[model samples]
Target: MSAAFFSRDIVSLPPSSPGMRIGLFGGSFNPPHEGHRLVSRECLKRLDLDAVWWLVTPGNPLKDHSDLAPLDARVRAARALVAGPRCHITGFEAAHGFTYTFETLSHLQKTLPGRRFVWIMGADSLAGFHHWERWDEIFSMMPVAVYVRPGSTRKAAVSRAASRFRHGRIDESDARLLATLDPPAWVFLHGLMSTLSSSQLRSRK
Candidate 1:
């Protein structure tokens, strides 16, 4: 199961269908759980996407690499938990040797043409997103959906990125059209908040 789960011989990885409205949900996915599943489903439904790629990254620049489990272990756990056609778990970052979000997004844009990709993340991530490397470049590359998260609505709303791009925010009713819009566009989804946090889950261990 371990050998086949990752099969490190992979190069380039399989591409998604062209013109597919895909959501790029990038993360370490240190431990797969129901909350990640719930977020993907909600993003798919709200954005009217054809599929959601859970980009299981090799490592996160913002996180301590030593604190994370082995890449294959994390990917295997993700593969085990993610089911159905719309949800895809790909270790593209690890396979392609990409580490940062900007690098991955740039690669995807060049690799998959005609495919509309939207960056998806919880509100808490948004609140601190400005601190990320080339964070502004990320906004310029794709539309972002800041899903409502427990206790993060206010902080995210007033975040540096949100404030800088406040004018680019569109109504929730127009969420389905996010992929069609240009960069600097984003939407904050309210009332769809989830109570799950990866850190919270890890703490219980």
Candidate 2:
């Protein structure tokens, strides 16, 4: 996808104020589904986040983009599905030409220094997180919250990234305080898993 696609439907990020706890949920979101909403809601409740940002990226460097959807279309779909005063959708990654997770996250921390931001992801993502660029630095930059995805808990829990950061893991009972904690902190939230995924939906189509 080209930056032009994002220019067509640049989404405004959710309102943020100093000291507010926010969750940054970045993904291609080629086709937003109920699972995405589930993660956002869980983060809002578990992390005590003031808002959740659904970053609709232009593409994922780790995945084949031969069949990826247009950025504008994906952003529109995300906006329609993730309806909530606290939920927001943005294609800023495309707008700014950020090809890696670290770049986008670094920008967020630099620009929104006053906000307490937590990186949110599902167990499925965590299972392959080590493959992500600057994966470890992500933990050092801000806190993380991983929600259980149906059938992915075991793999994620034993993944390399998890093993490396095991000492930084916090008990689920401390979830609400995750955003306020210092770097290298994370919590694994259990219950209410979702089996839905964009790839599954596309394959069915």
Clashes of each: 0, 0
lDDT of 1 by residue, 91-196 (tens): 7576666768999999889978889999998888999999988999999899999888888889999999999998889999999999889998999876555576
Find the number of clashing residue pairs for candidate 2: 0
Top-lDDT structure, candidate number:
2
Tens-digit lDDT track of model 2 for 1-205: 5676445447555568899999999898878998899889888987888999988887899999988987888888998997779998988887678899899999988987799999999888999999999999998889999989888899999999899999999999999999999989999999786788899999998
Tell me each candidate's TM-score.
0.91, 0.95
Compared with the true structure, all predictions reach lDDT values of: 0.83, 0.88
Model 1: lDDT of residue 143: 95
Candidate 1 Cα errors over 4 Å, as ranges: 1-14
**Residue 165 C-alpha lDDT in model 2:** 93
Considering summed lDDT, which 10 consecutive residues are worst modelled in model 2?
A: 5-14
